[model samples]
Target: MVQEEKIPSHVAIIMDGNGRWAKKRGLPRIFGHRAGVKAVEKIVSHAANIGIKYLSLFAFSTENWLRPKDEVSGLMMLLSEFVDKKFFEIIEKDIKFVVSGRLIDLPDEPRSKVLKLIETSKNNTGMVLNLALNYGGRKEIVDAVNKILASDIKDIDEKVFSGFLYSPEVPDIDLLIRTSGEMRISNFMLWRLAYAELYFTKTLWPDFDEAEFDKAIFDYQNRDRRFGMTDEQIRRGNI
Candidate 1:
């Protein structure tokens, strides 16, 4: 059995291919997205069960607004439903809820729901569930830069600037997983993923479950995280 000590402290996921999954099944795209929420619930429980401290999910991106209006509206409705149905479960599990992204742009009902959930879960002690809604990696970085420039700090390094992000309390991403065979980061957590290990899988978001998640964890266990040290130096413990 693999040692549980090797499990990553934080895992970020780019949940993709919902529409494609729906198309493959000859169902409406919204059906796939709805199903994806179920997958989200399952994965959250599994991550907490396996001792992951933080799980950040890229649910919607800033660029997603360019899609058809109907689709966007549908997504918002689904998000509202998700919060209404899952907030209790999240609280029961002691999972703290947080949201990243341009939340001011969301509609009033969904925005209010998100805020309520965050407030309700703020005191929880279990895993953190960070939902990236209307988020963009580049946008987050740019916002951080703007904030730094606007502040009174004389000099701002990477560490200093990171503190100005949406959730500065969180640590850097330890592992990033992108589903549906996507090899790119898709503008997700560009700054935070500086040293994160990347994992890609062909499984689509709606179909990703505990088994697939375990596979990613298993793969992560075998990696050599030298962090730029030469192989021989790493082996000899000589930095």
Candidate 2:
């Protein structure tokens, strides 16, 4: 069992290198995407089983829209199929599914599936599974600002500004994990990941199994999240 005090309240992941995995195997990129979905399934189940309060997966980004049409189309189909196949299982496990980003960019089929998942998972009281589709950190901040400007409240702080984000119900990210050795944040969860501990691994998305995930979690538990306080201040529990 995880120590309650050491568990990260929120964890975010950037699932990268699906295309590279497929290419290395002399298979189509879509093959890797399909495999990556399976990895997602395994990780989500494991995270919930471990009592992780929040898990965010970077499934797609705004930049991903610039990819080849055929590849993009395949990704959308895979997403819809994943929802259709996993919806019932999610409900049975009492896991809440949440999505971040603009739904306008999604096709009707996947959009419908995503909406259905969010609607169905509304009452679930367990771990939240967040998907970042067509999402960008800069865009999120811009949207938040636009919302703040449109409102009558002249004074704006971090707490009030956060309410305009896509999934304000979810708290700030505590741990951010990116696979395939990527060092960049790639414009995901800009505001929510401000204080998140970052973990980077060379394992591709399809290969990121429970063992790899556990390593990340274990490392997270070993960190000293002082949040800018002095060592003495934190030791005294007065910061």
Misplaced by over 4 Å in model 1 are 236-239
Candidate with top TM-score is 2
Worst 10 residues of 2 by lDDT: 1-10
Sequence-dependent TM-score of model 1: 0.96
Clash list (residue pairs), candidate 2: none
What are the per-residue Cα lDDT tens digits for candidate 2 across 49-118?
Answer: 8879999999999999999999999999999999999999999999999999988889999999999999
Whole-model lDDT per candidate? 0.92, 0.93
Question: Which candidate number has the best lDDT?
Answer: 2
- Report the error of model 2 at residue 78, Å: 0.6
Per-model C-alpha RMSD: 1.4, 1.2
